[model samples]
Every structure is written in structure tokens, then in C-alpha cells.
Target: MRVQLKHPARLALALAFGFITASAAAAQEPTPEPQPAPAPAPEPAPAPEEPAPQDPAPEKCEVVIDAAGVPINAEPVTVKASFSRDIGQPARAQVASESGVRVLSAEPDAETPLTFTLTLDTSAGNAGDWAIALEGEGGACEGTISVLPASAPPSR
Candidate 1:
């Protein structure tokens, strides 16, 4: 035997069916994800720093004066400067008086790689200790001169 619902039972069944339909529709729709707080707008980065300028490299060469002959007023003396190593080619020499000594002339050795001689002298008024410097092909040498006054006795 089939049992049919009366008026109150039919109304209760309709209310239950409507509630289930609403729940199913709500579940089918996409739920909005909790939006992450907009990443606080990024602060501007600082500009990159410029590097400092560098200094020029210093000159480097190891050379020496072989002999700076004794100095006598009004008398020319020969001074020789020799480089520690062969420069692989002929070199031009530049001579300058470091002190008050006079450099009469400079000449490079014909057969040597880096060797030269200087003719140096001091006038009677310039007699005393003086300094001379020679530069050639990236090398430099300095020497002292002990000039004797005209009145001084000759050295043995």
C-alpha cells in the first residue's frame, strides 16, 4: 500500500528540498580566495655607487752608477752608469744634474745594451759635493760627485 503525504508533510518536504538545492549551488560557485594584502608597493632601490679613480703606476727599474769619477774644479770627469739587465736594444740616455754639478755631455756605449758615460765638471764657483742622475730605457741611476776646489791638494 502507498502512503501519500498530507498538507503539512508536503510543505516540510518542499522546504528541505529547497535548502539542499541552495547548498549545492553555493558549493558549485568558486569561492573568492583571500586576496593577499597587495604587497606594500615596493620602495624604490637606491642608485648604484660609482667606483673611485685609481692612481697611475709608479716607475720601477733597478740600475746603478758604475763609477762617478772624482770631481776637480775646471777638470772634466767621466761617469759611467750600468743597467742590471740587458734592455734588448740600444738605448738613449738622459742626464740631469741633481745638485749643482754640470753635465757637459752624455754618450751611450756602442756595443752595450744599456750602458753610458757622462762628462761632468763644476766651475770653480760650483766646487763641492754635487749629484747627478742618469735615465735610459725605463731605468735610472744616481751618483754623487765630490768636487775639489782649485786650492785643495790633489788626491793620490
Candidate 2:
């Protein structure tokens, strides 16, 4: 059938009819089947963050020396050294100073004050100080010793 819009009244009627027809067709188009709300799109999972690295524990040790006098002028002084904990066996042991000196020997003991013998540098003059540093698996520790020239003879 042919539809024609001739008069104003007919044109209005034709426009209304076309609009209603389009709406009816859209409404009848299967009602969209009542979809299940699309399951909320499954909310994408969050990405995992990388973990941070850790540092190793610090080691600890101690060193000490004992002598007849603060200023070790004598030939030999009993040296003692220890660690924060047991170091299994002796670690690197040495006696050092700005003045030349030497360690006779190191004797290890189960406890602190591991005794040793230190011989002063024959060439070292009076009034020089040196540090005794002991290092091992545990770590390191330092102590100080002084060298002094023999006292002057009795005053007149």
C-alpha cells in the first residue's frame, strides 16, 4: 500500500503513525532476553607486587691486651683477645703499630683474654702508641698500647 501526506492534518497523522510503528518494532525485538547483568565483567584481578630483598647479619668480635704497664716498655707483654662469641679456631692474628713491632706468638683460650706475647720493636723510641686489632669470622676489635723509653736515672 502507498501512504501519502497531502494535507497538514494528514501529514501530522502520517508522522505520528511512523513514530509509533518504529517504537512498536523496537519493543517487539525479543525484549533483549533479560541478560544476567553480564556478571559485572568479572572485575579484573589485581597484579601482584614484587618482594624486597634482605641484608645479611653483621659479625662481631673483640680484642684486648694486658701488660705490666700502660706504656709497654718491657721486653714482653701478655696480650689478650676475644670475640663476641666463640670463633671455633684462631682467626688472623697480628700486632701492628706505626712503630715497628712483632708478636712472638698467640695462644688461644676457650674464654676471653687469650694470652699472647708481644715483643716491642727494638728500634721504636719512647712515646709511641699502637693499636692491637684482631679480626676473625666474627669481625674485628681494637685496643691500644703505648711504648715509652725507660725512665731517666734518679735525679741528683
Candidate 3:
């Protein structure tokens, strides 16, 4: 025997069946392929470059005699000289004395505030004025040194 349903129940059943049919139909249809995400907008071009700042020109190299004219004897005499710029190499100090004063050693100091030392052999030289000449790669200085005569010994 056929079963009889109430009008409300029949209506509810028909709606449920319709929804299920629609869902099945949607599932059977082919889905569109996902598109790649849009490429990120290109970065703005970099700003134009500016020229770098330049350094000031270097000062002309020079040498100056700070002090001289020390008394000469068997001992060594020291003369001090300064350079406006680094000599980069040791300078040559030449001592020319009318009485034959000779330069025993000439050497530049190690660090900045550049300086030189000149040791003179006064034993061979007589009492007179000595010409001091300092020559370097970039500069030179000229000066004079004086030597005093040996004092006479007291009579016994």
C-alpha cells in the first residue's frame, strides 16, 4: 500500500531534494583554473647620483730650520728642522764648514710633526761658521752653525 504524506511534509521533502540536486549539478561542472597573482608593480627608478665631494689641494712642501748655531767641540752638535709636509723618505743633511766640520749622522724622527737630527763631528773642524744644508724629496732648508775655539788650559 502507498503511504500518504501531509502537505507540509511533502513540500519540505521536495525542497530538500531540489537543493541536493542543485549542489550535485554544480559539482559536476568544470571549475575555472586559478590565475597567477598579478605581478608586483615595478619599483620606482632610483634618483640620479650626485658627484662626490673633492679634497682640497695639498700645500706645497717646505722645510724650515727651527734652531742652529750651537758651539762645536769633540762632542756632537744637534740642529732641528721641520717639514711643511711629510718627506716620505729620510732627508740628507750636508754640513759645509770652512773649517772642515763633518756630519756624523742625519736622521728623521719617526712620527708626525716631522723633524730631523744632525750630529756634527766638531773635532776635525776649526772655530768658524758652518753652512747647514738639508735636502729632501720635496723641499730644502739652509742655515749656518758656529763653532767656538778650544779654550786654553790654565798654567800649572
RMSD list, candidates in order:
11.7, 10.5, 14.2
lDDT (0 to 1) per candidate: 0.60, 0.56, 0.70
TM-score order of candidates, top first: 3, 2, 1
lDDT of 2 by residue, 54-155 (tens): 765655445555553334344554445544544444465555645455565556654544443334443443356666665546455566666555666699
Scored by lDDT, the top model is 3
Could you tell me how far off, in angstroms, the CA of residue 117 lies in candidate 1 after the best superposition?
1.1
* Model 1 alpha-carbon drift over 4 Å, by segment: 1-59, 85-99, 125-130, 136-156
Pairs clashing within candidate 2? none
What does the lDDT come to for candidate 3?
Answer: 0.70
TM-score of every prediction relative to native: 0.40, 0.44, 0.46
TM-score-better candidate, 1 vs 2? 2
Error of 1 at 23 (Å): 63
Q: Report the lDDT tens digits of candidate 3 across residue range 33-150.
A: 9999999999999999988869866665555555534554667766666766665455577667476778778787666357776677777777767666676776665656676776
* lDDT (C-alpha) at residue 148 in model 3: 70
